[model samples]
Target: MNLFNLIKKDQEYWLVDQLKVSHIPNIEYLVAFDKLLTEWKEQRVAYLSLLMDEENEDWLLKRRFKKVSSIVEYTKVLDGSYIASNTFQVEALSDSRVTDSDFATLYDLCRSGSANKNKLFSIRQIMESLERELGANWRDQCFIFSQDSMNYGISIPHIEQDTTDEGRMFYFGVVPEQRCKGYGTKFHAISLELLKTLGAKLYVGSTDTSNKHMRRIFEANGCRLRDIKGIYRIDIEKEFIQ
Candidate 1:
């Protein structure tokens, strides 16, 4: 058999499906992946697949699977980043104009830096995905940012209501390249402004603690370090037989 067929015949070989947007952290990825595998075991796929958000572009790792025994093995894999558990806070802004070019620029930047080299989707793809996942309720809570005359942009979706006194859940992401250029600050400000206009008293956002740039932006905006959570992962194939 060809190498492809040989690999396929291993039965042990697994296809890890990056689910794209479950919104849980790395440690959670293993739990969710395993649950999914078990729930779909009849499908006959031996390996586990993981799902991640497109915004988690920087945490990719190289393949490093080792055999520990006949059925057990260890693999150190990357599963994006983790967010510190904390109350959400919002910052009000005076502006609310985001352009499509901004999203295109962000997509290009993310693709350029991504390790997986998975093709980045167009603005339409993103919108469709969001609509399918979020349903019509998405319109009441989210908006697309874009430049004049351009139809492409990023989607800003709102999480559930914040449990904190602030009444702000969290916003997902800003464009990749547009980051660190003060656009995030602007975006946050604008989002807060909108939230305030909608009678919200505060807003909150989450990011990987390792993401110094984003942390810095949040700090500069008057957001304080509220909590920290450690993220962990285990290779099932490694843990199961051990």
Candidate 2:
């Protein structure tokens, strides 16, 4: 029905066609769409990506593409209502940075829920890469675990720092054994308070569509659904891309 030339000048995102037609949702559209990707594949685009709203009725039009991931985003308007002064302390990676060896400990604390899935499995790898990517803008943003089982973590983008986006972006994940113990909910609540105290007017977060517990945690913390996107990806294997 529709073909979108989803590309940018800087090429920050993958070059892909976002098909958005609904009336017919016919095979012809899919055939034509496949041709577009084929042409771009010859041009050596970084990856072939597809994005569709979760509510789109014409989803079957691109059913051939592999569904890699989906995101459900929420935003909390903060006026300091959720701030907790006495409970939970959050520190930034930049302010209270950890040594390479010490970061291993933090990584182990976070490993309860991080199985080798779609994401790169190494927590230390992610942490170091994020710290490097954010550079001066990065913050430690960790909870000092009084117990050995789990450590709660949050990433809040600050206005003062040269953070990429607007609003205080925050996210939290709990250990599997530690989950169902209200830690997720408590993390959201305390994060709201921390963001409020830091002068954040709004806090935004997102989770995978499959993560029901996180969805509930955000809802319990007064976050409202803002957007939903279904992301599909085709790996650029030399055999497949060609």
Candidate 3:
């Protein structure tokens, strides 16, 4: 009875699968979640997070889950028509031989455009978690793009395991020094093409409402806005009282 995907980093975090309990009657999801919480208490899960659709929003709210932010979802069809750029070269992490210091620099680039004011995980935590989620070949899917030996940004493009043709840019960012220079658009386009090569026929992307840069990138890439979801969280260390 897997209710959510449990990811352990600096702390344990649960990504709730709303569809798993959608068939349950009103408040039944809450009952099921409560049982998992008790069983997982010794694991010290910091929090449980859920992207709320209308189906589970009402019941989730009843449990005093805090609405942290709203996420805008976008979708695009991959047509294998993307052309490679001659000006910039994209190198997969596995082939790039990025040193620890280089990785730290890349992590800094990701941190620069992060939407969360108080980041939940550290660099090591993030790296480990990504490896756990994406598996050993994660490096093959992570890439760095550069021009004239100067790096511009990074992108993690991969197909979602549950959906064969559905793809996602799990993470995408432009270095702080290169931001506002229109590199985000190019980087994202490259990622889309990369996903296509990975057998992705469609791409799904999301960004927080406050992330104007990312929102603009999605629009610039011509991705259609599909839906918006509320990001809700429950602190496991605290009592659940509404």
| Residue lDDT tens for model 2, 92-114 | 54555455466456556654564
Candidate 1 achieves a global lDDT of: 0.39
lDDT of 3 by residue, 2-100 (tens): 445444444667666443344656466557667766655556777877665555676667776777777778999987565546468899888987864
Q: Which scores greater on TM-score, model 1 or model 2?
A: 2
RMSD of each: 13.7, 6.4, 3.6
Task: Give the TM-score comparing model 2 with the true structure, all chains together.
Answer: 0.63
Candidate 2, which segments miss by more than 4 Å at Cα?
1-51, 55-64, 95-97, 104-125, 140-165, 168-171, 197-199, 238-242
Pairs of colliding residues, candidate 2: 83-193, 91-141, 92-140, 92-141, 93-139, 93-140, 94-140
lDDT of 2: 0.56
lDDT of 1 by residue, 1-242 (tens): 01110112134333333322335455555465446545434445444333233232233222223211111111111122212221233311113343444544544444343223122345555555444444565445554444443322232534323222232422334555455566555554445455454554444454554456556556655565543322222244553563
Candidate with maximal lDDT: 3
